[model samples]
Target: MRVLFSVSSWPTHYSSMVPLGWALQAAGHELRVLCMPSQTAAVAGAGLPPVPVLGGVEVAVHNRLSYVREARAGQWPYPWTPLHPVTGAAMSTLDEFDLGDYLRTDGARFAAASAAGHDTAVEFAREWRPDLVVHDPVSTEGLLAALVAGVPAVLALWGPVGTHEPAPVRILPDDLGDSFPRHGFGPFGPDLIRHVLDPCPAAVAAPVRGQRLPVRYVPYNGPGVPPGRLPRTPGRPRVCVTWSTALSTMTGPHSYALPAIVAALTSLGVETVLTATREDAEALGPVPATVRLLERCPLYALLPDCDAVIHHGGAGSAMTAMVTGTPQLAITFASEQSRLAERIASSGAGRHLPGHIATVETIQAAVAALLQDVAYQRDAAALRRAALDRPSPVDLLPALEKLAAE
Candidate 1:
């Protein structure tokens, strides 16, 4: 079988699909990744062939314009406020909006920006004639390509929210009407999503959707070598601190509280390992010698030895820490992130702090709790076991093959 995977330009999103891609390849099936030019290197680094479709600059411009338009329309909110308190059972406004907007627009802003690429992907799918296409929710182009090619399309969710909720009626964009007529798929809808490969464990998973398929969460933080000269084992309790590479771009410079977080961790006398990009590191300026700063280091490599992790609540970071059995202190600024952080806290595996309220004192207190509390460690280990008990990517191969054959 030939399998094609499509993803957004974001590295984190693409990384989530790598293990599945690897599983397919290992089964002697052919695989290719359809991505923007900017993501080609990341795809190739993972040893997958990249089929570059859209112009990177064009996509980037559209993305920026969307942000600008949303900001101008006052749709952009800072430090997402939850409808219910962190540990509450009530549904959040964010979830309601995301599901409603996603079904209505199918991510209209991004879809519109990548409309041309959607055509290109359809063309590629026709030429390549893959049996199956697997894609993340945001990469609607993959679904379109598969629909046009009469192949099965699988939705690979990066987190808990997407497939769990009841999908609303899909409102296809007028602009995309012409593209679908040739294939006779008049309008896209939730029914078109034949399968949903979810990586979240049942313990933290959202309410069910019929097509949901549980896949074990695998940690892939991109290709990187472990830093040399670091201690084999820390003499003290070691804590890892990190922020998403995309957060600063989306939320502005004010979102970067690495300096304060680092200071707080160091004050607790715990060994601090700060992972960041070169630009983020420079922005951080000088830090105390006690804090170890690593540039673009893979969290999967460093997280195993750490007792606890403090992060911006990215799905990759949260899953990496969870799979490693490391306690977490997630300081989230967005709704989706807050949901994940809340799950961590409620599960007894960690704690959540909203970015707005994540002062130095709160951060220090959370880290101290993660280190000193035995319950956190015990719960983290339990979560790790639950995650491992789920079917792995390779284990899903038979089902995917069956779907493709059908």
Candidate 2:
């Protein structure tokens, strides 16, 4: 079947969707991916074919106009009207951009690009007559077009659905319940659904409400090429520290807790790999040269050798640590993050660093406890076994394929 796969952007969003996309392609399905133009190269780097959408033009214009408006009025997103601009700072790193803000800030330009994405997809579907359309939730612009053109659409949600579900598309959870933190999935509660997904239930009733597909939470973050062996650093067990671009932006990985963590880990004789941006690392002050700092390594590559992981509860990062059978140290940055941290601690996979009191000492203590206690690792490994025992991509792909074919 010919399929038009749409998403918010590539590279950043690709890892979450590529495993499924590759499954469809390998099974002889013709698929074309659509995302923002800025992400073309990253998507291509993942070894997937790309179809660039012209949405970035509006994103660019909106950003500029927002600056102009912010300077003139000093109002944020101008909430009272639809002309609100969702500035970069106002958005969370994960699922940050909003169409309403884009529309309000860029006006006609945003409309034109959104229309173009719809038109392009519709035209492609009308010509190729794809059997189904699998869209990323953030690409509602494309989903709108698919609905107008009377095509079947399924939304692939990578993170928490954030309390809202767009219409005429299926909401498939990548991770849910207690497993959310263990697997780095969103902690989307029924309340979030009431707030975010319920507003337009009618638009999605037929496609989503009653029909929920089994979740597919597999992550393709395997160690990249060479998979070269690195010399093991023998020390008091090791713990891995990582941050998603969102956490890095939202709370600054260096927040006030850095010195405490670094000091604690050192005192425990545990080594650390602070995986984040160079700027974040610099902001963190003096680091023991022995502590490694990696800017762009994949999470999978880092998890295998670690005894435990320390992170700000992003679904992808959390899952990578869980799937590897390593203990986790979740530091909550926001409400969603705090929920995941609690879930992890409750699951016995790791401990939570209260966002309200995440001092250097609190962070240090959590890392020390995980590294020194073998029980956390034992429990973490058991949870990993449970996750592995559950349905995986190998099991989920066929089911999704059958759905598409039907």
lDDT on C-alpha atoms for all candidate structures: 0.75, 0.56
lDDT, residue 264, model 1:
90
- Pick out the ten consecutive residues of candidate 2 with the lowest summed lDDT: 194-203
List ranges where model 1 is wrong by over 4 Å: 55-113, 164-191, 207-210, 228-235
lDDT of 1: 0.75
Candidate 2, overall lDDT?
0.56
Which pairs clash inside model 2?
163-192, 163-196, 163-197, 164-196, 164-197, 165-197, 183-319, 184-315, 184-319
- Can you give the TM-score per candidate against the true fold? 0.83, 0.70
Q: How many backbone overlaps does candidate 2 show?
A: 9
Supply candidate 2's per-residue lDDT for 321. 72
Best by lDDT: 1
Give per-model CA RMSD: 7.0, 9.8
lDDT of 1 at 371: 92
